[model samples]
Target: MTRTVLLNNLDHQDLRVITRRSAALGDAVMLAHTFPAEFRDLQAHYPIVFQKSADGTTFHPVALLGLQDGQNLFLDESGWTGHTLPLAIEREPFYIGQDGDEWLVHIDLDSPRLSRTEGEPLFLPHGGSSEHLERMTSVLLALHEGLQATPAFVSALLRHELLESFVLDVEHADGSQGRLAGFYTLNEERLAQLDGPALAALHQAGHLQAIYMVLASLSNFRTLIERQNQRQAARA
Candidate 1:
């Protein structure tokens, strides 16, 4: 259950949010939604891929964190090991909502991260925004803007038929195998076959770099498999 309400210094003056990463805090997931604006940072740490909405109407990008459900390979007792956390993961317990023509910050009152005596304070002693609050606001703003731009990026990919379905089969050291499917990836061949004008158009829109980032990110799948293997060995 959730009790989401518009944030205010008075009502939430004493609120503190736990900033640590852990599965108990809802960080155990196989993937996190990502946007083109974040591709560069994400490419270095995760395999970027695409998944269709449940309704099969549209596509969105995600940073793969594990091979199986309810697993996050980058998470450990010390916290996330990735070079960067996806904005979707970073903007937890707070969301942006529209109140008429204005955007307002909303807080999840039921979140386990919330507390009164521990973690980062949301407001200063004088009831003003604290540094932590300011940083969270910036994260929320960037996430909002990035999500607003995602549709155009997805549209561009679809218009060019650059998305292709793929299946990955993995074999662990224990001779166990796993298969991942129902995801899409950039079609390098189609992208390469584009004419000069098409290439120039993609470049102008700044999607060309994002596309390559997605391609480069695929290399990290090897890293993910290695993490999975290590986990398996530990369990054994």
Candidate 2:
């Protein structure tokens, strides 16, 4: 059998380990990529379809981490519309690929330097633009999934340019839920104020550093601000 590990060239920067999967008897980590057990132990406490065969049973990563080789690694499934995970799942692991159960993801290289063969390692390689787009979309979707928590996440999303504009979808004591679109700009001053968790929340919101785009639109905002000030002075 041949297994291809895509995006081998990606630089796993700021790679934070969110959660791990374990096994029965609780002796080892569950590395189920191979045989009888193939499940992703999502570190999050959310309910998930751990294994296809298991029914009506929802468990967290701790339950599965008993198997050392059963498999255990971080599961950063924050921005997921997919809170639930499955066992023995394989995916293109990028945005531009198919979307569904056990969606997988990883970063892509600016220029993927493809070696002649798969096994042999080489200097950095390059993939095509389509691959790049896939990476971008994949990250965006993942980012969107990560922002479900944290107070004022919506405001943070707007600041980060993840949501172009939003309207009150529903209002309640809990807070407001709204639909988000468009993108925004971000600045160092603004970013530095947020904690790591907050930034992760914004990213999971599918902002994709959307702040850069909003920054590009600063001139429009300045104009609007000036116009409003002039109008206010005229009224006074």
Which candidate should be chosen as best, given lDDT against the real structure?
Answer: 1
Please provide TM-scores, in order, for all candidate models, with all chains considered together: 0.97, 0.19
Between which residue pairs do clashes occur in model 1?
none
Q: Write the per-residue lDDT of candidate 1 for residues 1-236, one digit (tens) a residue.
A: 88999999999999999999999888999999999999999998999999999999999999999998999999998898888988889878899998798888899999988989889999999998988888889889898898899998999999999999999999997999999898999999999899999989999998998999999999999999999999899999
| Candidate 2 local lDDT, 1-236, one digit each (tens) | 22223433344321222123222212133322211111122323211111222452221111222112332322212222224343322221222222475444433232122223331232224522334444344444544343222224335544554322222132222343423122122344756677788767656864434433333333333332333344346556
How does model 2 fare in lDDT?
0.32
Q: Candidate 2: minimum summed lDDT over ten consecutive residues — where?
A: 31-40
In model 1, what is the error at residue 231, expressed in angstroms? 0.9
Model number with the top TM-score:
1
TM-score of 1: 0.97
